[model samples]
Every structure is written in C-alpha cells, then in structure tokens.
Target: MTTTGPRVEEGYAPVTGGVRMYWRSVGEGGPPLVVVHGGFGVVEMFGDVLERLAAGRRVVAVELQGHGHTADVDRPFTWEAFADDVAALVGSLGPGPADLLGYSLGGGVVLRTAIRSPEAVRRLVVVSAPCRRDGWFPDVRAGQESVSSAGLEWMRRTPLYEAYAAVAPDVDAFPALMDKTGALISGDYDWTDEVRALTLPVLLAYADADGIPPAHAAEFFALLGGGLRDAGWDGSGRPASRLAVLPGRTHYDVFAAPELAPVVDAFLTAGG
Candidate 1:
C-alpha cells in the first residue's frame, strides 16, 4: 500500500506469538523476497523504494506484533519471537525458503530468522543493522536507552508516531510499542559465533554515515569470513557473503535510498 507502482496484495498470516501477523506483497515472478521493517516502522514505511526492490521478483513484507495493521498482543517483544513469526510467514509463502531482507531492527530479526530457521531462508540481506549490541555508536546506544524514559507526549509528536497512528490497529498503543522496543534495544547480545557458523550466503548493507561505524561493519563482514582474503582476480576466493556501504545515506534513510535495490538484487542473483 505504501508503494507507488505495483498493485499491492494484502493478507494475514496465521496467529504467531498471539498476533495474527499482517503481510503484503507486490510485483510478480522471480524469487520471493521477504522484507522486515525497522522499529516503530510499518510496511508503509518502505514507501516507494519497495517498487524498485519488487521489480523482477515478488516482494513480501510483514508488520510485526503491534506495528502497522497487526494488533498488539500481550506478549513481550524479542528478536527471537519476531523471527519466529517472520519465519512462519516465509514458510507460508514458500514452495521453498525465501530470500530475507531487513532494515535496522528488522535487520536483526531476519538475521535471527536465518540463524534459527535456515530451512525457511534462501539468502539473507541485512541493512543498517548490527549483529552485536556494541556495534552501535555510543550516542546511538544512549538514545535507545533513553526511549523508556522519554515522555509519551514528546514521542507522540515524532514522525514515527505519526506513521504508526496512520495504520496501527490501536492508535493508543503507540506508547506500549515504544516501551517494548526500548526493552528490546536494551538487550545485550553477541551473535558473532552464530553468524560465523552460518552456511547460507548473506549480504550486509550499510550507509556510509550510519549509526554503526564502518569499522564495526568491517568487523561484521569479518565474522562472515569476509575481508580476510584476497578474493583473487576471478573472485573465486571471496566469501559468498558480501558487504556494501552506500554513499550519501544514513541509517534513518538507508531503507529508502535509491542505490539499495540494485545492490540487493545483484546479491540475490549472484552466481545464479
């Protein structure tokens, strides 16, 4: 519904984590790509950029618990819980596992999906998301920490709130979503070993000026066995996983950046 070109197809997945997740699709043919949005983000947040990503493929997007058209449930929010719901949705859409993409918080979710339910994922794409809690800049971490303490009136005035109010099942539940997200953000995690153990191909995409530093991005790539080899002239030595740092973008806007779709498409189609 947020896109400009493609005719959107909407539906709801069977109950997961006590919420019947809402999902939508666009485009036709080619491999399916399932996209998950950042925190406080709805399917509509993808806006027109989804049109480009949907080209030559069918793109499926989901609204996590309490976000967008999905009604908030009593359960708490956690990366693993969201991943389970997404994985189930992916399975529901599949004759086989689908390629997965996520932005920021959603990036973390899909990463967990690949790790927890590899059978339901073909390839992975993580945009502006960090695998470890410490990957974020100190200031960014500070901001997440302050979310629970931030006044509701102040948050209600934000664009995030406005967007949520536009499509949320319960408009008054915005504060609850914020509180849950704050708790999710405050969690401490280190997925280095898990990522290192992954057998499926992965793509890590980031903006040049992101909440995570380029050094941390390199560290993440290194975990996937990237950046440690010559990758030879023929590129045979390079790891199938990749790292891309788009110029002229930041974490907040990278999801909609014009350059993102081609990069993701290329990765999804590489060596096919």
Candidate 2:
C-alpha cells in the first residue's frame, strides 16, 4: 500500500484587513483538504506531516498574514478576521464539503469556519486547538508581557513552545510576535457552544504531554458533545466527535508527529 506523497502548488487570496494569504497545496486533488497553519507557523513548517496525510488527496497548507513568507497585514490579529480570510480562500478555491484542518491558532480558525458554514465543511480535524474555557490562561495579559520579554530563546528552552522560529535575524522579535499572538488568542475566541452545532466529522488530537493537558482535550470533547446534544444532534455514545491523545508527544509534535499520518489516512479512508 504505497502512497503518492504530497506536492506543492502556490495559492493566494486577498481578505479584509488588507491581508493577502499565501498557501501551498499538495497531493493529487480529491476532495479538497485545507490545512490552516498555526499563528506562528509558515507553509513549510508542517511539510512532513501534511505530505504524509496528503498522500491520496489534495492538501492545502495555508500561511496567514505576518507568518512565513506571507505579506504582513496592517490590522491587529483576530481569529474572526483570520477565519473570514480562510473562508474567502476556501470559497475561491472551488466548492463545497472541503476538509478543514487547523493546528493551534489554525485550529481555532477551522473551528470558527465550521461554525460559520457547516455546509461547506465535510470533515474537521483540530490538532492541539486552543479554546477559551474558564481560566484558559493565567493573567493572559501578563503572560503576553512575560513571553514578549523572554523571547524565542526562552521558548526554545521550554517544552511549552509550539511555533516556528524566524528564518532570519529578526528572531529577537519573537517575544513581541508571541505576545501579539497571545493577545489575539486570549481575546474573544470561544468554542464553548459554537462548534457543537457542527454535524460534520470532527477529530480532535492532543498530545499526552502537551502544554494544554489531555484533560483539557477531554473537556473540550465533553463540551462539544453537550453543545451538540443541546442542539438535538447525534451527541450520544456514537457521535461524530472524537478525542485522542498522541502518546509521547508534546505541543510542537502534535501536528508533526509521524503517528499522525497513518491515523489520519485511516480516518479519511473510512470517512470517505
């Protein structure tokens, strides 16, 4: 059972906030699968994992504004705006029922997109997606300040970090970068009741050793179920939502984990 690995195709779309997104597509073009990169991620950061999962279908890895090689936008960071940008990109690509997958910040965008247009998404996979549960952060404002002051060198030393490093000399700016990202993350984004209405297939993957604990992942799954049950959907013992913990993985490896490939392959195959 050999697979035709992922390939790359350039993609660009303009959105509000004057942001122009740059994305790369891989695989052989079945039902479109869009891969939204994390806040601090670039297109090629998830190359290994995306390529493997994209073996049999089209996989689009996106680079949001101010990340990777994408042009920086003048507006402040907001997941709603980012999600809208994704909506525009996905809308421009082709048609309905596309697979929406997001990692970290990207996952937040995917969740919002699924809620925004459930009809457009066939399957949703959110890897280490952050949520705004009660006490989701510790003095988020102060946390931003701390991360900004410490910079990427400090992040490199901690197991809590999950974003990509700068490819140039501006690595010193990571603290501010992370601070801005954190501010946006801690803002108004909340998956509490929004994602529960989605009836499409949903896969939630979190690392056993991730910064956001597996308990949080389970809680997210439970909350999702509660929401769906309230909406009179299939929120019973056999529902469309699932939560899995990747053994021996951390925040950064949640998406890059080698084990992810086969699991995703099986899931997509079975779903199809």
Candidate 3:
C-alpha cells in the first residue's frame, strides 16, 4: 500500500522542563489535533495517519524528549514529565484546548496529560496503550523487563534506528533513549481510577491482536462505562466513551491502518 505524508511546518517549542520539544503542523482550519508518536518512534511513524487526519483539520505532531529531533536532558523519563511537556506545548500554542491522539507509549503520555491538565484537552484518543502495566501480555511484559541499552547494537539495524539517524538531533543518544524508555516501560503503573473519572470524551482504539490482552481492553472500556447494560432505542445508556477493535491488525500496524483515520474522524466530529 502506498502512503504519503502531509506537508508540515516544523519548529521547536522552546526549552521546557530542561528539554526542548520538537513539533510539526499540517492542514488548515478546524480544531487542532495533537498527534503523539509511540516509544522509540518519531513523528514519521505516524506519517500516513497524520496525512489522513490532517485532510479535515490541523494535525500537530510532537516528538517527545530523547526522540526524533528532541534532545535528551538530565531528568528521568516518566509519563508525568512527558505529560507536562505536552501541556507546555499546548500552552505555547495559545488559547483553547486541542484534541489529543496518541499511539502506544504516546498513548500513555496523552492519558497522563489529560489527567494532569484536564483543561488542555478537548478530546482524547488512545491507541494500543494499556492503563496498567499488567494489562500487557505476559511475554510482552517480560520482553519489556529485559530490554536494556545492551540491545543498542541489535537496534542499529532496525528501521527505527534508521529513521532516527535521518532526523534525530543527536543520533548518538539512541542508546540513552532506549534505556530511558525501557525503564519507563518496566515500571509498574495503574491509572484506572483517574481514567474512570475523566470528564472529557475518550475513544479507545486498539488492534484485535494487540500486545495488550483483549480482556484488558474490555476492562478499560468498562471503566469508561462501556460493556455495561445494553443501550435503549434512544441510546441513553451508553456513555460518551467509544471503543474500536480494528480487524486484521496488530499493535505495530494499527496506527497505519487505512480504516483508522476515518473512524477517528467520525468519533471526534460526532457531537456528544
């Protein structure tokens, strides 16, 4: 399948929390949609999705610290820290809340940002990210635990590394990014309570065969008032939350699925 990325207007969002966050924007008119990429990922990873989403509205793609064009800092990498950076970036953009869409590691950061600065997010879309560490499959959890900087040599041959080499501000810092990301993923965490209390609308999209267990995804939807009682003819029983399990997709390719952008646009555009 051939996919083309949107033309972007890129710039740095001045140093905040000791690291300068890099961002790029595409499209015109309509509400802004902040797109956050996954772990060990750059803005290019969402190239196709951004291209599709940008067709109807502004899409702002951001690269977190130690990834892509953003440089590393002394502070430890944590969801809270990433959330703060996103919030700061939104604040710098000017007034009004922007919609947020995140995939994998970026999904967790977006969730935390919604929780940390509720006023900054108009809507939230989390793709393939679990609210708790244990939500992932056992093998996936084990793999995360064993990840370390020692795999740098192996990673050198990966497309992720190649992509980084092409655009990262400091290609030499790839190992550091991997180490910090590993540490973040290895840590145990749970945000069920916060998620359950969220007031803004949320759309939880995941691949049917995601790294996270399907059971966990259902559980998360339950937290959002989904899978409860059946909706009446008028559909009053259903919560504002939405969920979609894309068929024939995996954790790695869900973000690139041709069906995703349209579904997301429908959800975001539908009135509550």
Candidate 4:
C-alpha cells in the first residue's frame, strides 16, 4: 500500500506576513495529500512517511509558523491563527480539493480547517487528535519552559533538539494559544452536535503512548459514530471511528516508525 518514492521541492510566497514556506512533494498522481506537523515538528520528521504516501499520491508536507523553515508570526499564536495559516497555504497551492492528514497539534488544526473550510477537504486522516470535550490539551507553560531551558541553538546542535528549537523563541506566547486550544477541545467545536457538518471520510489514528490515551481517543470518536455510521461502515469504516493502537509505539511512532510504514500505507490507501 505504501512505498518510498522520490521527492520534489516546492516553495510558496506566503500571503500572511509574507512568510516563505518550504514544502516537499512526493509521488506523481492521485488526489493531493497534505500533512501538518505536530508541535515541535516539521516536515522532516514525517519525510519518510510522506515519501511512502507519495508512491501512490501527491504528498505535501509544510512547516507551521515559527517551526521548521516557516517564519515566526508577528502576532501571537492561536489555533485559529495556525488554522488560518494552513487554510491560506492550501488555498494558494490548490488546483482542487485535497486529502488532509494532521497529527497532534497539526491534527487539531486539520479539524479546525475542515470545519472552517469544509469544501476544500476530500479525505481526512487524523492521528492522536484530541476531539471536542476530550479534555486533553498540551500545556503551553510547560512547553515554553522546555523550549526556554534548552535554547533553540542548543537544540539544533543535537538531532533531538531540532523541533524544540523551532518553537523556542516564541515560547512566551504559548499560554494564550494553549488556552484557545483548550477551549476548542472542551467545547466540542462549540457545536456539540454537528459532527455531520464535517461530512467527509475520516481516519482517526491513535498512538497508545499519546498525550491523550487511546481510551480517551476512542471515547471522542464514539461521539462521531453516528455520522460515521450514516456514511456506512465501522471504525475507520464509519459506523464507528476506527481505532488502532500501534504496539509498543508512542504518539510520534504511529506515523514515524519505520516498521509501521506498511500499516500506515495500507490505511491511507484503503477504500480508495
């Protein structure tokens, strides 16, 4: 279902703050698949999986503001702001609707984008996403402290520090974003009963070791079961949002593990 493939370089002139974004493309055909990275992550973390996805479809992975290669925002960070960045980027690059894949923070952003711009998304893949009222939100203060202590430069010197370094400078502004993210997570998108509004095939993937435990992820997905069932199927099938607990894996491993590549590939390509 998935295999490694060559990559193509692509650059875009950002509409917001003129921040230039560096994105990589994989594969040559099928619907475009876009990937959004988690907090402290950029495209490189998922490069291998992107390459594998590219073998059958176009895979575009971009850095969020203040992380990876994207420039820092002049304004504060918020889920709305991040979602706006993703919306703008996708809008600028689009030839048509594209498949969307997001993880952790990126996964939340993808959900926001789907609600904000439902028309632009085709298939949606979310890994370790915190659903409405899920009560799992990363603490901005803790993240800020982590980034501050390590120092971006110090982090960059070591392979593990790369992502932390990317978001380090703006650590002070994290609290507000964390608050906003928390509100979204606890309010169920403020609709509480509009899962059908998204109206798109969604593949919910959870990592056993994620910030939100797999059990919690399953609970949130259960709320959306009605919509999935209306769409006809079970788990990733719809009747129930699908659940996969990557054995001995953490939140990041579900997507980045070398051994799980084949599983991920199969999920993305299934029912295609």
Candidate 5:
C-alpha cells in the first residue's frame, strides 16, 4: 500500500432528519467518491486503500450513525434509515451525483441508497455485502442469528473495539451500537428485485472466501444481467456491471487489500 498522499480533511455533515454524519476527505481532482465503511468500522478501517484512491480522486469516507465519530440516534438501526442518511450527506456535499463505494454493512446501505435515491448516486460499488439474508454462508447466517449485545465484552480485545475507543464520541455506547447492529443483521431481507431494476452501472467486488457463498455472488451477477449470456465478439451483450473476486482474502480483509483500489478505480472511471 502506498503511504504517501495529501493531508486528509475531516468534518461533519449535518444530515437531514437529525444526524451529524462525520466524514474524512482526501486527495484532489477527478470525480468525488463517497465511501461508506462496514459495521463497527471507522474511516481508518479502509486505511491504505482510502489513501491510495484519494491520490487520483477525491475520497469522502463517511461514518454512519453509531459508528466511528458519528453518535447513535434514537431511531432504530435499519438499512433504509442508514441509506437515507447517506443520501442526505451526499446532497449536502454539493449538487450532481457522486460515486459510492461501501463494504459489508455499508455495502447494503449504499445499495439501498441507490435503489431509494438513484439520482444521488452516479456509480455503485458493493464489497462483501449480500443483497439477501440467505446469501451468506450457512455458518455466517447462523452466527449472525446468535450474536447479541453480550458479545461486546468478548469484542473488547478486538481491533475494532480498540479503533472505536480511540475515536468514537461515546465509547460507553459500544454495547448499544452492538445491539442495534445485531438486530439489523439478524433481520430477514431480500432485495433481488430492486437490484435487478437498478439502471446505474454496478460493481460487486468481494473476496473469494467472503462470508457470502461464491455461488451466491454469481447469482447476484446474474441478477445484474451478467453470467446469463455470452458477450459476443464486440461485448455488446454484457451489462454495465462487473464482478471481482480478490484472491487469498476473506470478508475481514478484502476492503483493505492492496489490489482493491485499482479495480474500483478502473470500474468507476470506465464510465456508463
């Protein structure tokens, strides 16, 4: 990962409907890329990848409600609510749509944002997030079902906890965030039909060993008009969509991989 880059600019965007979303901006020139980090993730979670991407384009990494510097609101933690928060943040940034990239929980949030307010998103990238509840591997699904706020004590030793402690506005609210996230993940959901109708170009990037099954990734690609027919010599039959399975990585490490930035850059710059 490249270590050299411009200084990062950090600030909070007052999102409509009662939330002050925190964001970090880096780099200059090119189109703006709004990054949404996964659950329990802060801007630092993206680390080098965020820095690298910022080298060529502006990278706005946002902290969703209850995550990172953003404090939790009274509203229930639902994907739809988070999506709305992101859309409002993007709008507050400026006019015109911005490219969006999200990982895991953030991935689901970005997808929902695209569906709910397509005009706010110019390009979409979803990394290691499943569109439906059952898309996860059996073990992952089972684990999500059993997770609870009590796990907060067990997670205290983890890097995520440490990171949160360093920057979270109220470290004492960790347990509450965990409970809300647990409820959100454990809930049932399926957005296959909505995804199929998305007109914007989409990229589904994941680790080969992601929590989601490899077959399910292919199923998602098919839903986006990929894997169903040959592209022909001119490649006209292919949809404006892509799938990338990074090697030797898992859901935990895919977003931080050195190879991710370039793939995402190429796809987003490819244009519609």
Candidate 6:
C-alpha cells in the first residue's frame, strides 16, 4: 500500500490530567468523527485509510497521552484516564455526540468512553479490541504480557518505532511508551457488564483472523443483544448493534483493511 496520509489541520486540546492532547483534522463537514490509532501509533500510521474515511465529513484524529506529537504526562496509563481525556476532547470539539472509531488499544479507550460518556458519543466503531484481556488468544496475550523494556530491544527496527520516531515529541520515550502500554495491556479486565449496558449503536468490526476468537466476537455481539434470534423479512429483528469479520485481516493490519471504511461509514451514516 502507498501509505499516503491525509492533509490535516493540526491542533491541541488541554484535556484531563493536565495533558494537552494533540489532534489533527481532515474534511470540513458536520458532526466530526474521532479516530484513535492503536498503541505506539500516530495518526499518520493509518495513512490513506483515514483520508478515505474523511470522504464527505470531518475526521478528527488524536494522539493520546504520550504517543506521537502528544507528550507523556506524570500519570500512569489507565483506560479510564484515556477515556476521560477522549471524552473531554470530544466535548471540546463541540456539543457533540460524535461518531468514534478506535483500533487496538484505542478500541478499549473508546469502549470506556462510550460507557462513561454515552451522551458525548453518537455511534461507535471498535476495531480489533477485546472487551476483556482474555478475549485475546493466549499467544497474543502472551506477547502483550511479556512486553518489557528489557525484552523489546528488537523493536527498535520495527515500524512501531519508526512511526513514533517520525513525529513524537520525545523520540527517546519510545521505551517508556512501550513500558506503559505493556503494563496497561498486561492488566486483567472484563468489561462484559459495561459493554452489555451500552445503549449507543456499536459496530464491532474485526479481522476474521484476529487474535480475538470468533466465538468471543459472537459472545460480544450477543451481549449487545445481537445474534440471539433471526431478523425477520424486513430485518427488524436484527439487533441495533452490528458485527463484522472482514476476511484476510489480522489484528496487526486490520486497521487499514479496505473493507473497514465502508462498513464503518455505512454504520455512521445509517444512524442518521
């Protein structure tokens, strides 16, 4: 893929926890969509995929707490903290109930945002994120668990490092980013109750080959009141929530999957 990112108007919003979160905007239409990248990622990492999502409406992409142009703060990484920051930024943008899309670590953050501040969100798209830590395959969970500064020396040569280095305020903090993210993902969590209570429309889209098992996805859908019974002739029986497993995608590259934008766009527009 050509990896051409969108041309954005960049800015920052001083959100919770004394952090000035960095944000980039594309398009100029109403009711913006907020896009959050995976851990150790910057906005540009989504490349043209984000641009494509911005087709007719605005897309606001954020660099959370310590990633990319956003500098790290004194606080440790926590889902609630990040979610509050995101919620604050969403309100700052306008009197919004904006559409939200998040990938990987971002997915967890937005999930909390939708839970904690449902009024601030209109529709949600969760890509490659698990409600519980164990929702991930044991091997993937092992990788997340085993991450440590000492154990990640080899990552200096990977795209994760290069992407951060390109625009991070403190490039050397890559290790710290890894450390915090490692600790964050390594923690135990089960958000089933919270997810089951969400009243907003959610699109639980993932790669068919994702680290999260298909059974887990079905369980998540069922929790959202989906897949329990048949949709009648007019599809009225289908749950408000939607589930998609895009073929040929894995957790690693599903963010930029070609099939992603269409479903997400359809879900967002369909809400109107």
Q: What digit string (tens of lDDT, one per residue) describes model 5 on residues 90-131?
A: 898788899999999999999999999999999999999988
Query: Which has the higher lDDT value, candidate number 2 or candidate number 5?
Result: 5
- Provide the overall lDDT of each model, using Cα atoms, as 2-decimal numbers: 0.89, 0.70, 0.90, 0.64, 0.91, 0.89
Off by over 4 Å in 4: 1-7, 132-134, 137-160, 163-196, 226-241, 259-264
Q: Which one is best on lDDT? A: 5
Error of 2 at 63 (Å): 0.6
**Model 3 per-residue lDDT tens digits across residues 189-211:** 99999998999989999999999
Those runs of model 2 whose alpha carbons end farther than 4 Å from true positions after fitting are: 1-6, 133-145, 149-179, 226-237
Q: Predict model 3's lDDT versus the native.
A: 0.90
Q: lDDT score of model 5? A: 0.91
Global Cα lDDT for candidate 6 = 0.89
TM-score versus the correct structure, for each prediction = 0.96, 0.80, 0.95, 0.74, 0.96, 0.96
Give the Cα error of residue 126 in candidate 6, in Å.
0.4
Candidate 2: how large is its RMSD? 4.8
Tell me the spans in candidate 6 whose CA falls farther than 4 Å from its real position.
1-7
Clashing pairs in 6: none
Candidate 6: minimum summed lDDT over ten consecutive residues — where? 1-10
Q: How many clashing residue pairs appear in each of the predictions shown?
A: 0, 0, 0, 5, 0, 0
Model 2 lDDT per residue over 162-224, tens place: 334443224445565666676676565467767555677788888877657656677678766
Candidate 5 lDDT at 62 equals 96
Model 3 per-residue lDDT at 60: 91
